[model samples]
Target: MSEEDPDLASRRIAHESLTRDDPTGWFENLYSAAADGAAVVPWDRGTANPLLTEWFEASEPNGTSKTAVVIGAGTGWDAELVADRGYQTTAFDISPTAVETAQRNHPDSQAQYVVADLFNQPAEWQHAFDLVVEIYTVQALPIALQATAIQKVGELVAPGGTLVVIASARAEGQPDAEVEGPPWPLTKATIRSFASAPDLRLIELDESPSPSNPTATRWRAEFLRD
Candidate 1:
């Protein structure tokens, strides 16, 4: 018999532990550190994601009248870019520290930065946004919660509006191998499964090596609410 892979077993255990409804207090701590102006989030590039910017510039000209909502708007980079496209953008994170930092960083961008958890979004937020941008947020949670996140994304979009997601893609059956992570990688099939919900219709799915990290590929998906 083949020897058991300890690494895979450990990963499963870790994921199972993390998937529970642990209070999001740690997220608040992260924001607090950032608010103190010393914390450096690994995913913060200090600027908008270039590929996302490109997509916006290309699609904005053809998009319908709609306000944009950016989920997990860490540090406001993507939110700023979305606002630059002339959309009325509202961005939020569960961390107050992150929201404060975002407000400080983009003092003049007019992007409404708020602190809100996706799992329990305010009732008024339902079906309120025309454009929903989901970037690196779903993968932060355990794989089992991905469907919940995807459902929330759909809930935020207005009828016939669009939802765009950007995430790191992994190979099938390979569990997350990182020691500790906020930027968890997900497989393309997993992403498709999330986007395949009844309320959202998949429009496009594109995969290419991330320009910033040639060793890893990124998946960009566009979905429309029906």
Candidate 2:
């Protein structure tokens, strides 16, 4: 949220859009603005997240080649990681412009870049992917919509597969009202809530302070479906 904080007017518009019932269009708008050179895309690190890199690097590539989907795939760096590991990766963002940007970023990418809303994912995707990589999309949403977002994340997980999540974390007792943000970080309670679905169970969860902000922590969670 630090660098993503654009000019005051732009931030206001984005927050207003999220507070509405849709609670999601602001991402597309923000990415469009960034594309038009109005603001910067703070999360577009142009490289894979270290947590993801470490997770993959430390493990043996043992899973059979199966369908994988990257939610909020953005510019496709993380999707590339999954693809490199031999997963049939399908990376998606809510914004058509963002998907186009991702495709342009990785011209030879094996990952299929598409614009798909998490809340309205295609019916064919239910229980379809072997691995679901969702990073930061929920915290980027207002808390009001995060519950639905959580459910959508679980819905994308196929039986006997896994879901990988990385998101900004909040400490105990930090009220959402205290933080006015388009990218409102989640508390540990919120992070664990994604495991509430009976179909999924948390296998591992890690918390650490953000490298950029010592006060702000982040969570990397892995869930498995039984």
Candidate 3:
């Protein structure tokens, strides 16, 4: 089907429906469908998030061989960007299709792409990373599952490491109207849900204009594991 086809838009909306709740089965099924090469995810922009790239360039994490993990690493744009910054990066997605595509796209990069569910990750990954980048991954799950996702993010960062989350921001006091989304927008409070973790401290939380899509506001928060 053509990218602009009306049927494609309908299918995109259908894919988004799987995120309405923490429906692991539904998500697995959706990914399975794509595993055989079925649909193109609407959110795959084919480029690194400019804001994240800017942050990494400016911060220059001060050490060689730092390890970074990208959660829900759809299309691997963010992962590639981080890896390019000299961090040993691992990018994971629950969808095998997405992981495969990322590997194919970044053949020369040292980024490791894997298929892993964030909700139920292996124990070996706990506290294994010096940097964690979460972009539009938490809100992709149901609101009730948001905290669990946040906790897992915290678990991935080693002490004194950084956790960076980039998410679409909703206006204050916005109600949860019936909206279909894989790009589930979040409020400011929702973004801070992980900031107050006992083992982590909020270092910086900044919202800025989205360069590629200015219609949506974006938040980039950084936390340091204590």
Candidate 4:
């Protein structure tokens, strides 16, 4: 028999979680396993996402005197980048191990790392951030949960705030049946749901070749709240 794929353990944990009808639970399982050296988090790149950096360069967002949050902050590279940009940043993950690791990864990090569920966030977080960065977190859940996830992410943006989403993109009409994933790709229509909130406007949505895979597409969308 061929050796198991390196990410098979993570996929198995995700599948079991999904089978239990717990879409977000696998995250803690995976992160805990990684912490114990029994498995690895496939998405932990150990550096700030380049797409986010590209956005920062292009938009020159002035985070000074602003507040930001990084959803599914993982090991905190993205949160650190946002903190470095001068925002009072709060980064959160559903997994406590992940949050602890992020805190450990950046000992002197300015960002507040917390264990927060995307589905049930704190009351204070409602429309409370000037910037919200959601990189691949929504896509990591089942496709059926996309709309609710998008709406919750949007609700975090304060008046005049901006929300940036980066994720793997699929063709608009692509069949969901064909996509088996712990990382289900998002389509154009699904992405538009980010602006479904009455107060949010989709300012930009770009579908381009993924930096990690030239043939695969990536979506970098930006939304602004009224």
Candidate 5:
């Protein structure tokens, strides 16, 4: 038999969480297990996501004196990069263990890492950031919760600020029932829906081959709030 998939533990936990109607409750369970060395965080790449890095290179955003927020910030890689660009960064994760791990992983990092649920975000965070970075966070949730999650993400962007979303792409025609996932990949239509809010406008949406899996596609979309 083939070796067991490394992410199976996370998937199993997610399944149980979803069955309980607590879609996001698996995050803390998985992160806590990973902290005890009983499981692994399959998505913790230890470096900034390549899609995010590509955006930085192509846009050359000057974040100096500006504010940025990383949604579902895992172990701090993306947050560190944002901070490196001179943005006053706040990176938050629903899992307290993940937040603590991020702090431990980057001891001298400048980003303010916190434990915050996207659905119950602090009032001060609404429309508070000059730049909002959401990488794979939406897709990680159950498909039914994606729309609300996307809205919360968009609400973080200040007027005139930008929101960048990087996610594994699913063809628009693909059936959701066929996709087995803790990550139900985002379809083109769902990606475009990020701009449905009155305050948000879709600026650009690019689909490219995933760096790690060339056969798979990834979507990098940017939105601006009016």
Candidate 6:
């Protein structure tokens, strides 16, 4: 498949997997096909997200020896950033292929890459990390599952720990039903929900146009567990 054009076959297979009531199966199939550059991963930015990096720099939390978890770790770029900052990072994906791909991509990485479902995580992982980074993962799921994903994301933050959420932004009255997506941009209200209905408070919430595409925007939010 050409990098310029995403392989529709892979996407179709993934969508069918979801249609079959297998949420994680689509990710597995997508990653398996993406191996060896055979298919394009639309969200694989190929580098640690700049928004996350900047947040780390601004906060300068003493991450030394602290634990961090990167949700939907994909190819591990975000996890690598956390590890490099001195945190004991666990980068997990529901897709075993994605975990394996990340390990292969960065043989020297200090981050521990694992295959695990976000909805059914390890017992010890609940409220286990000093930091939890959720970047574009929740929005990737079907709208029906976003609430569950949001709840799980909050569950990972330890007492007084931090949560960073970065995702595409959806306008207040955009009539989302008309849009087609595996990546449904998040609305401000939905983003705020992460700060509420849970024991967390919003620290900062910013929405701005993506530099790459001015017409498209993103929500960069940070929250603190109470």
Q: What is the lDDT of residue 72 in candidate 4?
A: 97
lDDT of 1 by residue, 22-133 (tens): 5344556555544554344556778987768877776764433569899999889999888877778889999787888899888887789998999999998898888889
Q: What ordering of candidates by lDDT runs from best to worst?
A: 5, 4, 6, 2, 3, 1
Candidate order by TM-score, highest to lowest?
5, 4, 6, 2, 3, 1
Tens digits of per-residue lDDT for model 5, 64-100: 9999999999899999999999999999999999999
Backbone clash pairs for candidate 1 read 31-97
Superior by TM-score: candidate 1 or candidate 3: 3
Over 4 Å off, model 6 = 7-13
| Ten contiguous residues with the weakest lDDT in model 1 | 1-10
lDDT of each: 0.75, 0.84, 0.76, 0.91, 0.93, 0.86
Residue-by-residue lDDT tens digits, candidate 6, 1-226? 5554563655575588888998657888778878856677777889988888888899888888799999999999999999999999999999888999899999999999999999999989988898999998898787778899999999999998899999998888888686456677898988998986467899999887875679999889999987
Instruction: lDDT for model 6, please.
Output: 0.86
Please identify model 2 stretches exceeding 4 Å from their true place: 1-10, 19-21
Candidate 4 residues 39-58, lDDT tens each?
Answer: 88877888898889999999
Q: Cα deviation of 208 in candidate 5 (Å)?
A: 1.2
Tell me the tens digit of each residue's lDDT in model 3 across 73-188: 87788898888778888899987767877788888878999989897887988988999999878876656567788888888988888999988888868776653454457888
TM-score list, all predictions: 0.83, 0.92, 0.85, 0.96, 0.96, 0.93
- The best candidate by lDDT is 5
Q: After the best TM-score superposition of candidate 3, give how far the Cα of residue 134 lies from its true spot, in angstroms.
A: 0.4
The TM-score measured for candidate 5 stands at 0.96
Which pairs of residues collide in candidate 4? none
Q: How far is candidate 2 from the true structure (C-alpha RMSD, Å)?
A: 2.6
Q: On lDDT, who's better, 2 or 3? A: 2
Q: Comparing candidate 2 with candidate 4, which one achieves the higher lDDT? A: 4
